[model samples]
Target: MNIAEFKKNLLQDKISSAQEWFFIISVSLLCMIVFISSDVFLPFLPEMTKYFNTSMSLSQMSLTAFIVGLSLGQIPHGLLSDRFGRKSILNLMIPMFLLATLGCIFSKNIEFFIICRFFQAISASACIVIGRSLFSDVFEPLKAQRAFAVLVPLVSLSPALAPSIGGALSIYFSWRSSFVFVFIFGLIISLFVFIFLPETKPIEKRTKNLSLLSILNNFYIMLTDLKLLYYIFIVCFSTAVWWVYAAGAPLMFHKMDYSAAIIGLLYLPAVIPYFTTSLIARSLLKTKSVNYILNIGINGMMISCLLLFLLESFNALNVWTLMISVTLVTGSNGFLLSTAMSAGILHFSKNSGLVSGLLGTLQLLAGAFSAALIGLFANVFDKHYYVNLTILFIVCGSILSYVLKRKVIKHEAIKSF
Candidate 1:
């Protein structure tokens, strides 16, 4: 080939590879946004409580408010993306997120700050709902499972990192500094998304009837699917366990006289197991069934619960024991979340946006409910009670997974006959 033709071919190859990487990274970042938004400022909750002269339980309302917004906001974004396309909805939401972050920074009262957080989470919800839909839109079932395996670990980093960042910011500046950091981060990501993220949902495939009745009908159909319902419940329970730990742990540590920074550093240990098991799940996907991986996760969680119970019964439920229990549960989650979500989305691939929204709604609502339960009952429950609550959620999740597995086996047996 001539030098000019060779140069053109090289340019084309570079563009193709760059575009692929950009898409993967962008989706992973998108998935992380809500998580970072939710947990980044948790280390500062005590600071926020004293600053606003609010009780700790009321201060925690801020987290609950954001989570509520995250859950409720997803449905409309999914519906609109189905009708207008993902890029347009995301563009609109990113600006709203930036604006809400500014509101959070400028708030003079606790109530106003809580309101701003609600809107912040509302806008941030677009990232996760649309991000997951993008994968479903592009990849088939098995490939999507592998993609989520990669994406989940990357996404899990937010919860690990956010607290440390928030702690440093709180120690040196103020809780408001965390909001400023989030604002800058959102602006940079928004620019990249605007420039590089392609519209995966095409006009030809767009849902035509986006009326209220139609939306409700779609929800009814999806909710009635036994398989999808099982997947959703499994996700809900697993997520609730994490949120309980996230919401309760800092307060417990603060009571133990640990500084915000120390509490933040404490979160780092759990992430290692979570990240490692996620990688293991990805490797196992090649030989093992999704159900097999899920069974392993369920058993891991059950073991964690038993350990927690033993620790509590022996009067040994301290920070170290709590950390070990949490690490095990989070590690197990590495196997559960991606496999369940990919399977759920693949089952309803044609309505990926709506299903994504439904899944996101239920998932975050579970978190919100768990967090709120801790906050509301903080006065009534001791630190060890939080561990008990975590154990309860794990047991519930294991039972659900077992039931689903049995149903699958029975269905297969009948088919074989």
Candidate 2:
């Protein structure tokens, strides 16, 4: 079929089962690519520090820059995709990602590398925003929740796997090899999108008013909605917990004189619990309410943080203890993130692109803040301090989540009355 006919076919109310699976897999991969960009270079941070003659904090700036880009870039991507179309914006983004990856691979200094990573994240952020919006475009509320559960575990694999891949590449070649891998991955995904991915947002569905004022007003409205803010913060807190662990764990391991490869292998154990709880969360959805599942998750996180504090206090905290505690935190998040995100998006289904973008931007902004926080306190504090600080953040988040859950329930009850 010609381009117009092909596009029209994709915009149908119902696609074939095969097409559905293809779309799901493609979007999952897109999400994975963004996460890989975030985490693949983690194992190389120490090496980057030595090579660039910079401090660990400076090297960590690459991560902060990328996350900041991931955060800020989502707004524009979401706005444009809502105005233009998903596939077209994705097509534009993948090329930019490829170019940024090249810059990362060829950078002569840390400053230049940091800039490249930022651009790389900016481009890759489209995947996250549009990938989420596509689900809302295609599925009803209930199906979208299940789809998100599936998507979470798949995307979670990247953070678990990317460090291992980067460690192995650093062992065999150089740190730049990780960027090469990312570049190749981006190229393949670009081609796949060009050939297979469809335009989910048709002309009739797109936002007509593309003015700055309209966009700003939309942002204002969403920002003022306490329900949406609560859901977003739930995801954000979970995200921050993961990033704190991610940012601190590597440094802790490196200080212990562990090899990069072993440090990479250390992340593997968390994946088991993460995947298990995600599946369990999916199953729980069949019989339980979203609030019920969220309660379990929030409680799990608090209990995990308490355990970490107890372990650290008794001087029993080691790599194994730390990892086990973090595994639980990650597991709890698997239950929390997808459920909260889907609920929020479905609640505001008319503005799925904007919601998706706002959610991602805030989530990664939380992550970026956690990473920067870790970097700021890394040298001044001992390992125990990191653990303590992490616990504090999780506890605060859990408490806020509880308060917000109450508010949401009260607000909904009043509306029902």
Best candidate per TM-score, number? 2
TM-score of each: 0.85, 0.87
Indicate the residue-level lDDT of 103 in model 2. 96
The Cα local distance difference test for each model comes to 0.81, 0.83
Off by over 4 Å in 2: 1-19, 41-64, 105-115, 174-176, 254-259, 312-315, 380-383
Q: What is the per-residue lDDT of model 2 for residues 65-117, given as tens digits with 9 covering 90 to 100?
A: 98778888887898889889899899888999999999999998999999999
lDDT of 1 by residue, 1-417 (tens): 243433343323323444545556778987788888888888788888898888999888998798779878887888888888888899999999999999988988899988999999999998888888887776656666777887877886887788777877876888888888898889888966786565667788899998889888888988877778777877787788878877787777887788866877787777788788888998898899888898898889989989988998999977887888889988998888877887787788878878888888888778778988988987755567788788778877788778876886777688789
lDDT of model 2, residue 264: 70
Q: Between which residue pairs do clashes occur in model 1?
A: none
lDDT of 1: 0.81
Q: What is the lDDT of residue 30 in candidate 1?
A: 79
